[model samples]
Target: MGWITTTWHRLGSPRWFYGMMAPWQTGFGIAALVLLAVGSVWGLVWAPADYQQGDSFRIIYIHVPTVIVAQSAYMTLGAAGLVLLVWRMKMADVAMVAIVPFGMAMTALGLFTGAVWGRPTWGTWWEWTDARLVSTLILLFLYFGLHALRQAIPAAESAARACAVLAIAGLVNIPIIKYSVEWWTTLHQGSTFSMRRINMPAVMYLPLLVNVIGMYCLFGYVMIARMRTEILRRERDTSWVVELVRRPDVR
Candidate 1:
């Protein structure tokens, strides 16, 4: 318990986290690039076509991974928000701010790809009444709302506090988004990984898993990179930042 508290406090330090994440950022970048490239090739070229949807279903490789990581990123944002309100950790808010942009991009990608998938499959580009689709759009709007809120508030602390409340409150939508397919009738499909077994064939499923992992790696790389920059911006007046800039070895 004591060590846990020490480590958690240490993680709150910008300098410590900045240095600690250096190697991890490189690893994440390399892993994401390699995994995504390989997964794309495997999913697009080699994976068997869906019996029903044909090659058009190949977009699942992109669509599923994006939505999966997008929701996961929002969950992270909500957790950071909790930390911000509870412990008043500034680093938690730094992470909350950093997560919004990429999370927004991922959510947008998911919605766009879903619409593309829907065009051929359902013969429709958009479905307003579907629970899953509506919830996902709301998720994207929440990201946009957070950004707008931050910009609207002139005071940093006030913005953080307001965003924290929004992020936490928005969490109810996550479960709604996740289970919407089950709870209501919709064009969206149910869970891919069931409690008993996978709903997909092994050959098709493997590449999707790889891309999902790659997307998560990409998310990590982006978040850490942004957080590092945010830290530098926040600590610009400090001596360490001045010394860091003077050092030629800065990466």
Candidate 2:
């Protein structure tokens, strides 16, 4: 608890957090690249074709991870919003900004992959009645709403507050998005392999697991990179940021 609180306090200071995260982000950046390469190769070449869907199911390599990250991103945003609302943590606000682009990318990936998968499996590129599809679409709109809100608000503090409010409100859609297939009739299937239960063959699951791990690293890399940029932008007038930017090593 002490460590957690201390870390939180440190993160509240952009200079301290930026200094600490520099090396960590660099490490994750390298890991992200390596994992993405390995996972892509394994999923694309080594994984077996799905018995039901054949080669078309290979899309899962990209689709499943994107879908997973998209949901997780919203949850992260909501958590950040709560922190901002309660503690008024500027770090959390920065976190929310950092997560936006990555979340948007994931949402876009999910939509693209869904369309690609749908073409071969459902004979249509799109479907309106499918709850999962509909919810995912809503998720995309939520990302757009947050992004737009950030831009429209002029003041930094105002932008953070507005984005936090939108994030907290939009959080309601996250659970709905997750449970849409279960709550309503939909073309999308329920999770086949959840953490609570594992029912699939190792051969079929390993590639998915790898892809998921890779995507998680990739998400972290992108989030931290963007966060660093945000820190620099917001702190440009500060002496610490100025000194950091002027460092010989940095240049």
Candidate number of the best TM-score: 1
Compose the digit string of candidate 2's lDDT tens values, residues 197-231. 86667877787887788788888888888888888
lDDT of 1 by residue, 1-251 (tens): 89999999899999999989989999999999999999999999999999999999899999999999999999999999999999999999999989999999999999999999999999999999999999999999999999999999999999999999999999999999989999999998788876798999899999999999999999999999999999999999999889999998875
Q: Evaluate residue 23 in candidate 1 and report its C-alpha lDDT on the 0 to 100 scale.
A: 91
Off by over 4 Å in 2: none
CA lDDT of 33 in candidate 2?
79
- TM-score of every candidate: 0.98, 0.96
lDDT minimum window of 10 residues, candidate 1: 188-197
lDDT of each: 0.95, 0.87
